[model samples]
Target: MAKITNETKRYPTDLTDEEWTLIQPFLPKVARRGCRPQADLREVLNALRYLARSGGGWRMLPHDFPPWQTVYW
Candidate 1:
């Protein structure tokens, strides 16, 4: 797994190190010929989990997350 640079959990929705390792391989990765992904995959998942758990609108996501558009897409 790529090292998770931000280890501190800022919210209840963030992933733990063990959980991140198990899930990381399943997430889509950056294409070899395209621009690299702009947002961190782990953060995106955390934002998604927060949305699911809280039943919040995409726009309502906390600022610490990637933009709503990014997560929505």
Candidate 2:
């Protein structure tokens, strides 16, 4: 039997370049696109990962990321 690490159990959330291309049109967009965009799905997923690793309070997360409450449940 193989011993699975925590990393192995986590969901595969990394979006590939091609995969991102397909989902880009459908995901919500932030205003002011001329300069740069913030809060893409990748970032949100990353934040969720960090929460899982640290086991911290959702509200403790910085406001820049999505509500941890939503991500947890």
Candidate 3:
């Protein structure tokens, strides 16, 4: 498994290495022809977990998360 290098802050809902390894295969591969994604999937997933756990509006997501729109889409 690749090392998670950009994890700036730990969140309760953030997936551990084992969890991410298990779920990684189910996520779609990045498209090579289109513009590359700006954020990592792990970051996106963490943002999602934060949203789900906090029951907060998209616009209210903490700054540590990716932009709310990124996670929403």
Give a tens-digit lDDT track for model 3, residues 1-73.
2355337347788777777888999999989798988888988898898889989899998887789899999
Candidate 2 global lDDT: 0.56
Query: Cα miss at 35, model 1 (Å)?
Result: 0.9
2 or 3: which has the higher TM-score?
3
Per-model TM values vs. the true structure:
0.85, 0.37, 0.84
How much lDDT does each candidate structure score? 0.83, 0.56, 0.81
Query: Quick one: best lDDT, which candidate?
Result: 1
Q: What is the C-alpha lDDT profile of model 2 across 1-73, one tens digit per residue? A: 1222445433344444455566568866666657554334655665676667677778886664567665554
lDDT assessment of candidate 1? 0.83
Which has the higher lDDT value, candidate number 1 or candidate number 3?
1
Task: Rank candidates, lDDT, best first.
Answer: 1, 3, 2
